[model samples]
Target: MLDTGCSVQGEQGDIPKEHPVLKSEKEVLEKVKLEQYQQIASARDLTDEEFSSLKEAHDTPPSERYAMGKYRLMAVYNICDTTVVTAQWVADYDNEHEKKVYRDLCVLSTSKMQDGLNYIHRMEQLSLSYSIENTFEARIPHKLDDSQYIKLKYAVDILAACGFSGPFSNDTVTAQTLNDNVNQYWELTKDKMQHTCTTLGLKMPMPKKWVFKCQLGFLNMVLHSVLGMKIGSVNTRRKMYHLKHHPKV
Candidate 1:
């Protein structure tokens, strides 16, 4: 009869092989099997000195929601969002838009190049280290320094105003193209947003207390007044005879 070691060994329970598990833990938790949990615990954790060094290496603040990765950068650029404005649209923006982008960029780019470079370097590290299924897989800028966090939020506000939506793929190629050209598009987005501000008679150079109101009700009234009258909807069509004869209400 073949001795199946099952009787005594199983009854006594198998001794687990030892391994070290750290407080920081490996980022790829899914790859670890359930059985490995017992083995890892059995292996014992590292010594205090070793653990201190490892913890220092991986210690992130409790508030940080997102892991550092390209997806974070993708969210920063609004590439992961459903809407991606085309490179063609970016290139062909009107002068007013261009001017606004230039203005915004001037403010953003004024930050020390050394700081910007440091942020970019960190991004590159995170991008290389992590691959996320979506932008929401990690929180952002929580892990970033103050300057980097400001830039991320500023970029989101500016890019959205210039017609780029948040991260997620409604159009992959357009998103990828924009992602590849983000640095360049920064200038373009700034310009486009500036132009929009100008069109709406917004104060320029963006003051500390600057504010914008869409006034949708007023816009809807205008549309209602003009609709079905054969007055072209284009805002800048100066040749419209009705506009010349219109009363100043």
Candidate 2:
């Protein structure tokens, strides 16, 4: 009699290898026609009013569309945990906007800073390679230097207002807090900030400070309200330890 294990292995080894069928030109053409028909059917099914409404909605700008989509998604999801969901939403939205803003700011700031540094580096290279008198005399005008300095100062101020501080704080804040604070801040002073930044030609950093403040507020809310965790405890650990040891009240 054949061993059961040997028979099973033999059956497994005899598994069929089925190759995927490559579509012919005729098949491809038929698929294209089918897709086109589906599209036409979908378009034809829509009423004139529906089509107009869809077109109007589509015409809305991306920023507005993003806002609408986000709110609609939130309404549809209706997640029970407001804290987590709201935080996630803020984080997602901020990710899209903040990433672009921060990246652009970094690029612009780094480019200008690097350019200035490069000039200094080049000057150093020249000084090392040849005497100062022998090298081409290229000096940054005091006015231009002063203007750049002012621009940098303005940028730093904008950054501070936006809430960008340093590494330690930014990572700790929740997205919900970031979103709420940013929206509030933006609504209150966006136009003013824009005008000021444009006038000064300053590159603003990411709003780290706003994020931190919002996060702190959220943490306080969670600690005091939701979780009921207090900041200080009067030997609660000792009380629990005694209760465990004594067994009776």
Candidate 3:
């Protein structure tokens, strides 16, 4: 979950002094109004027509769209991530200078690849604790200076193979990576884990696949609680069905 309420910790310590992208009060306000609409849609699951009607009605003479846009940008920066803002009062201005601010803000806000990488790390730790029986080790040879895009891609591939998705797979690395070697040590040998439940006399109580689903659901719940995003109910139902059909007696 994205920490929307986290504040910038100190005086913009490391941010470059002359970077661009800030907005005026008018643009900020416009953006805020739009975000409100987005929140309303999310909260109420409103239809397109309903939203359009609301927007049309709200549109007024001497429109404050510019101000609203600026407000929305600031709000997003203020809440989602604070590494973007350079000046404190960029959102207050209404002149051409405000355009520069808006431009800079857009660039900074969207360039959060590092943030995504950090999320991958968190997901990896959570997955290992939930699924693997052994402790996690740092075997994957990740570059300390690798681009965020590469890190994100690597994490996604690892997770998909492990039968999970989203941030859950953030720690997954290529099979040839050193991390894979470490993971192998922690993973229960499949034959051993399945032997008693599958080979025998005892009816397996729950299938391994189902167990994974339950884990995924639990993970999803954690993410929703933390990030404010909703996973679809269909996915939950599918997981439950898998568990029921593949139970270990």
Candidate 4:
């Protein structure tokens, strides 16, 4: 949770002059935002419908409720690796600037990145800790330098495009650059990197593949695999049957 002890009013006039580093960082952020806005403004303006769709996709307006609410149950997104937590806030701003203060509390293993309110944001006040299921590296977001932010963002992109082999494999990787963020992530996950690098290539017993031909249901579903695509009335209406013989499973 953020420390809310300081008076919001006086800090504006007093803090920046006293803390030059804070001033400098805020300036850098201003420059970055200006560049972003300029790029957006330079684009061929979108149709109002397109703009509305994009805005709706981008933002979820926050609520005014500040106090902790009841612990209602919600479904979670499951993944196989590191934990990720994202918190969003439209900063406590006057109505005019509130739209511009939309910031994110992006926490990861070694970094905390936010747009507004430099270092002393409110979330620190909670005194919380996170634990990954089996790993014991503390999983704390360490101080991320500017360069590592690039690395972490790349790591995130690789995650977003998980199970995509056409881009990562050596044969098709000409589309990727040497210092690309995905490549950086490929380098950072050392165990994964070693496995990909071939510490040992052991032959495994031949595996059986499952092939089923089916059609007929409220929803028409077709699963395509290396075997082939086939249509069958397997589970339709009153009939549901498996293959007459097994493939030596």
Candidate 5:
């Protein structure tokens, strides 16, 4: 007989009443909320400002929480990666003068790519310590240099011209130029680089592909979290739907 952890005193029909697994969704959500509160209440290191923000999130409706409170949690835990955040905020600003000012404040020198190259190198080393489950735990340098950022944004177009071949695989000198920064930053062997990329479910582009994907992923988050865009196209639900067959359209 399988030794079920449930008490033998309870009859089979009564088991669902007491079993935590069988609880209603409302009950489960309440339990989770209570546990979060307990953890926050017991935390010794939370500052007054951090506690206030967390408490505000806790009181917020499930549909209305900011970045689902993960940003605040990361901030409190000292694991927040601000590199992409700084870049995004700089890019997203509407006022040109303000954007320039913010970019100058957050990013390194515009003339030199060395700072961005160094940042990528440190991030690559940091990723070795990250597990698949807690990959975001690696604390990277939170700033970038302008030249490298522009190169990263335009790399997709360059890769497109090369018939979308893997990074550094295309023989064109221009295509190979894209990999030069990566090559300079890489301290490990080619085999180790390939292994790291494979383990992370990443392409051969190493840090470029990884960082590009991260920037795109953050944009997706903003679309869904801030703009309330769902998985399917909103155009499909309209009265006069165009390109009804293709969701990608």
Candidate 6:
């Protein structure tokens, strides 16, 4: 069974033989971090540590509600509500999109992602090291440190926005194709999001405040854990985002 004996066991901070979902989460987390590094390094110089700090925001959940490999983020933008987004539409979307995905005619539902988030919240409340937390926290990015929390981490964005909806069939999705899909979606999503932001006043994301906090958090982890440098004066506030989902997301 996919659920039987599915657990996350680790040494100090590393998990050996990670669950499949956790493996996917880790891959996406590292991938996004690396992509952020390249972009920042291209614009300016950075050290490994500096890059890690700056990479805190790139492709982050705060910046994008829906992007690559983010299943739980499908309903990122708060464009509509469940009252308007009926279950029938969601059902139609699930059936229609899955049936003929090549048309890019299918849209995502924030309600679906919300349901996932709800389940994740329940799992987390029940346990800290819950296996679900590995994938949930990875997809959510509620933390800015290396506490095994790979947030905004998954293939939902890249797969949905490009591979699943683009001009290719599932049979042709090879490594090269997936790579191409990711790049293509990255460019296209930026343009679409910018347009939406400008026209709809969707509140430009990734404020400077977030970057600073993420840097602080990462540094704090390094200090308290790695170098044992507990300067004790740093106070961090947890910023939360309420995931709003609409059927058209």
TM-score, one value per model: 0.15, 0.20, 0.20, 0.17, 0.21, 0.18
The TM-score that candidate 2 achieves is 0.20
The full ranking of all candidates by lDDT, starting with the best, is: 2, 3, 5, 6, 1, 4
Candidate 1 Cα outliers beyond 4 Å, as residue runs: 1-151, 154-164, 173-249
Q: Candidate 3 residues 109-129, lDDT tens each?
A: 353534554555665556556
Alpha-carbon RMSD of each model: 25.2, 29.6, 21.5, 25.1, 16.1, 26.4
Count of backbone clashes, every candidate in sequence: 18, 6, 41, 9, 0, 14
Ranking by TM-score: 5, 3, 2, 6, 4, 1
What candidate 2 gets wrong by more than 4 Å, as runs, is 1-149, 167-170, 197-249
Model 6: how far residue 90 lies from native, Å:
43
The alpha-carbon deviation from the true structure for residue 117 of candidate 2, after best TM-score superposition, in angstroms, is 19
lDDT of 5 by residue, 1-249 (tens): 998786756566756665666667659787776555444333344455755776766476533243334344445334445333332232233233333333322333332324533564565455544533475643432222223233232332223332333222322233233344334323333345454333323355424554523433322232222112211222533322111111110
Residue 244's lDDT in candidate 3 = 13
Better of 1 and 2 by lDDT: 2
Could you give candidate 4's per-residue lDDT for residues 161-237 as a string of tens digits?
32222211222221223125334443455244323223212122122531111111100111011001112223545
| Candidate that would win on TM-score | 5
Cα-based lDDT for every prediction: 0.34, 0.37, 0.37, 0.27, 0.36, 0.35
Quote the lDDT for 100 in model 5.
35
lDDT, candidate 4, equals: 0.27
Cα displacement (Å) at residue 100, model 6: 33
Q: Regarding TM-score, does 2 or 5 come out ahead?
A: 5
* Candidate 2 lDDT by residue in tens digits, 54-105: 5578476544444444343333444334343343344343333333333323
